[model samples]
Target: MQKTNNLGSIKRLQREYAAFLKSPPPDMTIYLIESSVYECHFSFKGPSETDFAEGIYHGKFIFPYDYPKNPPEVYFFTPNGRFAINTKICLSITSFHPETWTPVWSISSMLEAIRAFMLTPAAGAVGGLESHSDVKKEFAKKSQYYTCPVCGANHQELKKIFLLENDKKNLTENIEHQLKINTSSTEVTSKLSNYDKTEYKLENVEKDHKIIIEKENNNNQQQDIIKEENDIITQNEINNECKEELLTKIENDEINKETKEKEEEINQEDDVLTILKKRQEAEKEKIKHFLENKEEIKEETERNEKYTVINETINIIFYLSIFLIILMVLNLLKIKIIMYFLN
Candidate 1:
């Protein structure tokens, strides 16, 4: 049963991969590992006008054997300042939240969602970092030259290739369109020239047309060479800029390190003060409880004393009534005796 499930998962992934090739996601490229359909590599540019802008991020997705029923683990190998490098991030669409996973959700949609999520605050999220805007911006700039260990290509090279491929496609389409226009023009010219026929003149005209075509081709080739040279110059400039930035960054990091140590010391002092305040509050609470208990005890003792006094007063009154009754009985007995003697 397990084997069967694995096979099904592979099939599903293959189908998805085919569809992906047919209509790839915009501004991103996904490459499935040659050995396994379960693992995939993806690269994309960071969203523009955001903290992550101008960055090319490389990441991986590891789909589970029971995929579609479970979400894949998402990991970013790039240091984008939003997520930790090579760590599986916790997101609603990731393996951490299987309940939210749906069979309909494809890799493209997940990438889109992740790009959007990148703009959100970290807020102490797992596998997320709360970097300063300046630090993030610096990272974004550095990302262009960053090389992906898995892909074995730097961001700049990857982007250049992507652009080249698009340019080639556009160039092909333009050339085809131009050829059709030239073919129609050739037919029209032939029809017009036929009205003023001369075989020798026609041959000369054809030769002139071939020369023009050759010149155009040479011009195109020269333009291509110039573009390549410009690209090389630009790359050299970028490298120099990166070196300077690295030097400045190193100096800034040293300053930041010192500031961090001072901040940590201040935080430690604040922590101690907080601990002392908590202890004092606890002592106050204990004292308040003791005083409350003492007051209750005092009130209870007074109530007991009042009850004892009332009981004593009732006992004294009862004894006095008994004595009066005894005296009255004795007098009545004496009167009865005297009357008997007189009789």
Candidate 2:
């Protein structure tokens, strides 16, 4: 029966995953642990306007055999200090509140909720850890550089790309705005100009031998207008170039400073394979310890049962011996009374 449940769970997971792949949530990355379909690693961008802002937290989703019927357990692998590292965290979507769980809720929805939940006050749960708000903020700042060996990437890389794209976007917007302003100025200047924009028909002077002179005059006026337009366009180009140069320099300096910090953080990241090995060994050890404890408790229970039986036996024997002695004394007293009466 349990095996059947597991098969159903795997099928459900695959279907849900396909749906997620169609239109994945922004900034939330979840991937399967191929060895264990029930296990999935996830990373998400922290909610803004919170202590966890600008942070990327890595964790896992552990599902049960009866899942979709039951919510998955959520664990945080990264040390945000807001959540205990490698501990099962409590959330509405986790097994902590199974009574409220519903099959209608999907993994994507649950993860979205968990990200938002990070900003709220922590419940005093046994598995979770607590830290000062300032400490959490510090962790948040450092989270960007954290690398996941399994994913082979870090938040810093994403940030770097975003920075470059953002710079280009700003440059484009600025140029567009400046172009609009220039166009408006050109319109206003042309409107208020003393020169008339009236078009002269060359056909009207075709019959006259003075047609050649009129055409030359018209050509000279067109050249002057073209020259003025070229000057405005050249000036706009120069301004854009100067603005881009200054922006690039400032952005480059900031990236350089952060580059050193990211280097140091690179050393802190654990190789996923090594982490898996250690985690497996740790889990085995814990299971062994738990089994040993179970055996000890069973032995203790058996000993207590024997002790209770022995005590009961000893009490019964002692009472029977006392009852016999009382009966013997009473018979002796009866015999004495009978002898005294006969006398």
Among these predictions, the greatest TM-score belongs to: 1
Runs of candidate 1 exceeding 4 Å displacement: 1-5, 162-343
What TM-score fits each model?
Answer: 0.48, 0.46
Minimum summed lDDT over a 10-residue window in model 1 is located at 242-251
lDDT of 2 by residue, 1-343 (tens): 4343355676687677656644457666565553455677777777778878777888888888788888899888777877887778887778898998899988789889888777666778746667888888888888888786763546786555334444545555755675676567457556753543222223323533453454466456546545654664575457445534543454455456567668766755646667888999999999999988998899999999999999999999999999999999999999999999999
As a TM-score, model 2 comes out at: 0.46
lDDT tens string, model 1, 1-343? 5432265676677667656655666667776554455788888888978988778888899999888778999998878889998788999899888888888999888899999989988888789888899988888888888776664646888677556655656666766776776677677667765545465346658865875786588559657955874785687457545534543454456457668979999999999999999999999999999998998999999999999999999999999999999999999999999999999
Local distance difference test scores for all models: 0.77, 0.70
Per-prediction CA RMSD (Å): 19.7, 23.5
